[model samples]
Target: MKKTTETLRGNYFFKQDELIYVNRNDENFVGPFHDHDFLEIAYIVEGEGFHHIGESVQKVRKGELFYLPIGISHVFRPKSTSGQKLVVINCLFSPNLLPKLIAFASEKPTVDFLWRMRDGLLSNYSVRDRNDRFERLFQSMFEQYSTRAPGCEDMLHALLFQLMVELHRSMRESENTDQSLPKEAAFQDLLHYLRNNCEQELTLSHLAHLSGFSERHLQRLFHQHTGQSWFKYWQSVRVRRSSELLLRTSDKIQHIAEAVGYKDIHSFNAVFKRLTGLTPSQYRKRE
Candidate 1:
């Protein structure tokens, strides 16, 4: 029989009423592959090790914070060198632990993180602590959990809230810097507009005007951020979307081509074949 999440709770020594608390400091510990019902926020307090999540193993050093959603089989393997210890502060909690009022009142970023995790979008997400504040936040939360003073639960909630806000900001900044331009709100809006308006006639001048930037400036940023010319990037997006429509809908090839901004069937077939190495008909047949 597959182990349920409640089994993990029993191993972690969770009391009946306490669903959220920090794990005790582990020294030179090797964990077994396990899946759990609750979500886990793991902060490496000290030492270095390998984090095995599903089929991938990532080197985890001190100052890395990772959030593992429910039911991901994972384990931490301590480095074999002598005197090396791996300590992690794991905050485990059920989805129902957080009040609905908190989710409703939280900032958009915080709410976004919650919803993404709930919707199974942010699996195996890890962010290094660049500002060194995340470790401190975990330490403070662990201390509060240990103390159990009056209003400790509220304090834990506040600390977790701050951690979530910081994590969301860090993840956004990391995404912006990862092989892409600083995709702040404006850039995201531009992408959204492009995807929605892919069927329409697209031009650099039109995009530049819509973006409220000069054509030269928009072209420069677009190339620098995406490592592609605006026209090429737009074409790539259109072709990718066309592939989705090809397999998902019974739309005719000419209509699909027109919907993806290509009025000419030959032009669409050429571009799609170049990118996907298969004609649309061939790709759909395989699917």
Candidate 2:
């Protein structure tokens, strides 16, 4: 049986309040050339097929993720009608959210990806999800779209952000050295540095110098990934490290405070109590 590939516009597909559509589909054969008014991310879940995008036809297997920007006509054709079934998960979202995506994206590749779409410069491209990480995230968005729970819209948007960032990371890992994002290396390195070096009195100015970002930009970067301000993130890291010391080591509370970068016991006790709702000594007692 032949399949139809005439996808209707946004109004025909999306629901009210929740404007995204997600479905796991089976493709039987090649369909007519069709374009969409919205953006799409298609994850091939099972079987093999060929994707006809723009002027290219690429052999696509399971774990291949494709990006289809608006107005890009494309179709999927299964390799054979009698072979293993071709399963795909298609996620369609409105173009209205692209502005927000461009605004909140902290890295270059992501902004580059969205800009390519905005300027009509993007050709459809596919990436391989070697780790099955994308499969899990796609499943999550599928479930969230299905359930439509409280804050479902916000959750799906957040998950979409996660998916894009993951796509960027996978791209970086797959790129040759010359094709990499040079100075704007993923903010992941700086995040790890902060988590690993909580003992130092790390300042925003210092971190900004290291990351080649303005102090304000670095603060926004911190909030983007850690959901906390610079001072709060550093404080939380310090407090959490102190908790581990409190539980694992025989160090005195005053020494633990100093070890985690606090100059005095009083300040450490204040932050620890506020964060844990227990004084350091009381927390130790509970354990």
Candidate 3:
């Protein structure tokens, strides 16, 4: 079997104490499944391709950048059509190469998310330079590293740090854009629970325990998010489900009331009338 995980010759890419940089231009290159000891940042500068990261294959296009954590097996399969070529810029650096940038990010509110990406919790953490911000940064760094001009090392570090900050900013922006309300998964799950278990005895304590939140906090969130008190919202849900049962089933009023968490017919009738402006019998008769 062909050996997987092509261990890179570190000295060939890096000069002395400098980091590794590569501007790969290939017409039909199929890089082997491999990994590096240091973190790798690969940017597609031209053409499109498929990246085999671990067990998953993701399509990559021009102006896209991917951050690969150390020792994660991956390979590049560049696509070509009508003599077109794929161009990629690879930036490989030691763990300590970005100390200042990492330290600055550690002090930010998105520190947990940054750690998630670094720890490979996101697995395939990638961002497309849709606006060409990262694209230009990579281009400038590649030129400096390839040419080895005077003060090129300093210039490269500056560009690399800028890209690092932009990457963190972009990731946070994307996350914020995707999650507009900042609601926790448990809160959403609670809504799902309420929808399915409207007939069950659900109390503030039970919901707070289920969501791992304080009763007062959960109650505040419930009313703030839905614009209704917990009891009122749950009563509305029970009433809605009861309306459906009334139309679709021949169950009696007392049984229906009990089935929808109402042990007393009078209480159920009063709530139903308050919400729907009609008694269960009247609703059933009309439908």
Candidate 4:
């Protein structure tokens, strides 16, 4: 990935509530492990290196794909003195933007593999060749991403569907390799509760009781699945909602704070500044 100091020459892009960055990386660059609120997929257009994902590490080369579950801490960089060239495309999207069927299917590979790929799975499929017609689909996706046009959302959807189909075919060819766990269903239920009740006064005990787990167990589950504590995750949800309100509405800062369950405007301002590096008023004005 390009450093913050690098100047981008192309019309690099971002979507409403989503982001995509395509960049080239030189050798010996290491990014710190971090996690965020969006799912990430990285396609290696070229290069060879080691990718550290959760507890698993693997060598990644050209035409390889890596899936990062939302909020899973990981890092990727060159691993050898020879270094490597990399063309990286990173796409981040909110879970709310996904279709209901797709969202539900994400918890079960029996269904989800047909629609999407889960985290921690790497395939060595040759996406550069059209010998079996599979490369044609990849080429179409590459073209759609490279030359985004009007109604590109439709194009992106089609390309994503094609990519999923190719991955599903690969999974079937490999004898339906089962690598993901079934814990996503329970996690999804917990997340749904959190999203619905974000505006209410919530506590660890309350959330634990609602999710049918003890407080400690709930914390562990959240850390395992999302790579963050429940409190920090909930704070991110509040910050994101507050950011939306700040951008789109004329609501007062205090009111926006209250709407997201912060009773004290001072505390809200402090936390908001800590997370976003801007005062609420400043954020709104900049937006």
Candidate 5:
């Protein structure tokens, strides 16, 4: 079948020799499913909606931020039943900005993570707009775009980079907060983290780092508590999440699989069947 996706051109959106573009829109006006030639940072300003990205139509509400890579097909549709229309602030730029960021930034972990973001080492990410500071920063970028003041292009570029640094800071602070668990957390705290973040890419090595446990120790703990290896335990968590999505939403099988962190639909099918003794399709039909 021919693809129905619309393609957005960078030249059309980024004018005046600008490195960044900023816009705010009421997403209630549903638009064509489209991919673009540049990176995009879209933040929900208010209200609620569904974001159609990849194969998922995930419900999103106010304070959500998404970093979309080039060629990622997506669109926003405001909730039909909501009193308030969904609003979003979008910041767009080419992935080519990475080199400049690298040249200007210090060798900090935050900077390193931003590189991963542009390099596709990390998957698309979304977070709550809990930081008022970021909202103000985004608003400043919008104003800078509309005013076209002297040096506005440079100003917009700086503001965009500032947002990236602040994002890493906020998220790191959040992680530190999560890590405040007592050391004697006895894998309980780490287990809870795995359950809550099953959608994330957490490997045994990473989990060991998070818990200050040796990888071998983590293996033993998993076997003791769950009668499974570390990978098997996490797999069960993801499969359980997949089952919940299957029963609770009308999303496609592929969408459900991705939502649970399975990139390959075939792998998802095999695992779901192995654990539940029913294919995802059959499981859904049984309910």
Candidate 6:
């Protein structure tokens, strides 16, 4: 038997850089397939279940970790008729938060690892191995969440760094890797343009001009590499920024909308509903 709950109600918890949620499930529960923009790492603290990442399905047990890249679809549920007990640490992190990590790896070496990992490359590491250093790090992270002490953010960052290092190591050990490099130089330029001028009305023509690509060529390249059109991608960035305002500030919806590049609330509302299935006011209520 599987059960479902709208745990966070809405995406209000992660308006800023990211949000962390610790979930304890004491009954048989199954999640419908879903995906999000931020990276997700799930640590199964107890019991056994089947996890579906992309097209591959595998059994996940206590002390095991599941890593999901941005926009990757995944689902997990108990493997038995009886209920199961499990603890899941859900971490949402911005891709921009780890520039140093990405830059350190050669573009060819890293993209292959990232692509394979996205395709369900499970590691031999066990989450229940209490002796494992990474397990200890997770325990410490759980403690920080529990205590909410001063300097918790610093502690969390340290733990996250350690976790990333371990994941990178695991990635290196995987075989049949695809080591082709991405057009990172061009992508970085696009990132800079988006960050600096998010407030201004931006268009594909403007972005293509800034990136030194013809508008049609830029559209083809962006879609082929990033899986989204320029307009759709920029809207995602704006909506993410707007979510932060809605969660952390008392700014009016119209004001928040404008701050994120929308000049009209109606347009903002339509886009918000399309992305999150909730109007700004409805989303605010969930918060």
Q: Per-model C-alpha lDDT, please?
A: 0.78, 0.80, 0.76, 0.62, 0.82, 0.65
Error of 6 at 178 (Å): 19
Q: What clash pairs does model 1 have?
A: none
Q: Could you tell me how far off, in angstroms, the CA of residue 24 lies in candidate 5 after the best superposition? A: 0.8
Which regions of candidate 2 are displaced past 4 Å? Answer: 1-7, 107-109, 172-287
Question: Which stretches of candidate 4 lie above 4 Å from their native place?
Answer: 1-155, 158-182
RMSD of each: 20.4, 10.5, 17.9, 20.5, 18.4, 19.4
What is the overall TM-score of model 5 with all chains considered together?
0.57
Per residue, candidate 1 scores C-alpha lDDT tens digits across 61-133 of: 8988888887788887787657787888988877665454255444766776776766668767898775466
lDDT of 2 by residue, 1-287 (tens): 33344765887788774467888888876457788888889999999988887676889999999988887778877888777777899988886776677887887879987676666675566887744678989999889888979987888888887887887676666564763354345466676677778778788888988778898988887787789998998899889999999999888998999888989788899999999999999988898
TM-score of 2: 0.56
Two-way TM-score contest, 2 vs 5, winner = 5
Instruction: Name the 10 consecutive residues with the lowest summed lDDT in model 2.
Output: 178-187
Taking all chains together, each candidate's TM-score versus the true structure is: 0.56, 0.56, 0.54, 0.43, 0.57, 0.45
Residue range with the least summed lDDT across 10 consecutive positions in model 1? 2-11
Better of 3 and 4 by TM-score: 3
Ranking by TM-score: 5, 2, 1, 3, 6, 4
Clashing pairs in 4: none
Candidate closer to the true structure by lDDT (higher is better), 1 or 5: 5
Q: Where does the lowest 10-residue lDDT sum fall in candidate 3?
A: 177-186
Worst 10 residues of 6 by lDDT: 1-10
Candidate that beats the other on TM-score, 1 or 5, i.e. the better one? 5
Question: Which candidate ranks first by lDDT, i.e. highest?
Answer: 5
Model 5 global lDDT (CA atoms, 0 to 1):
0.82
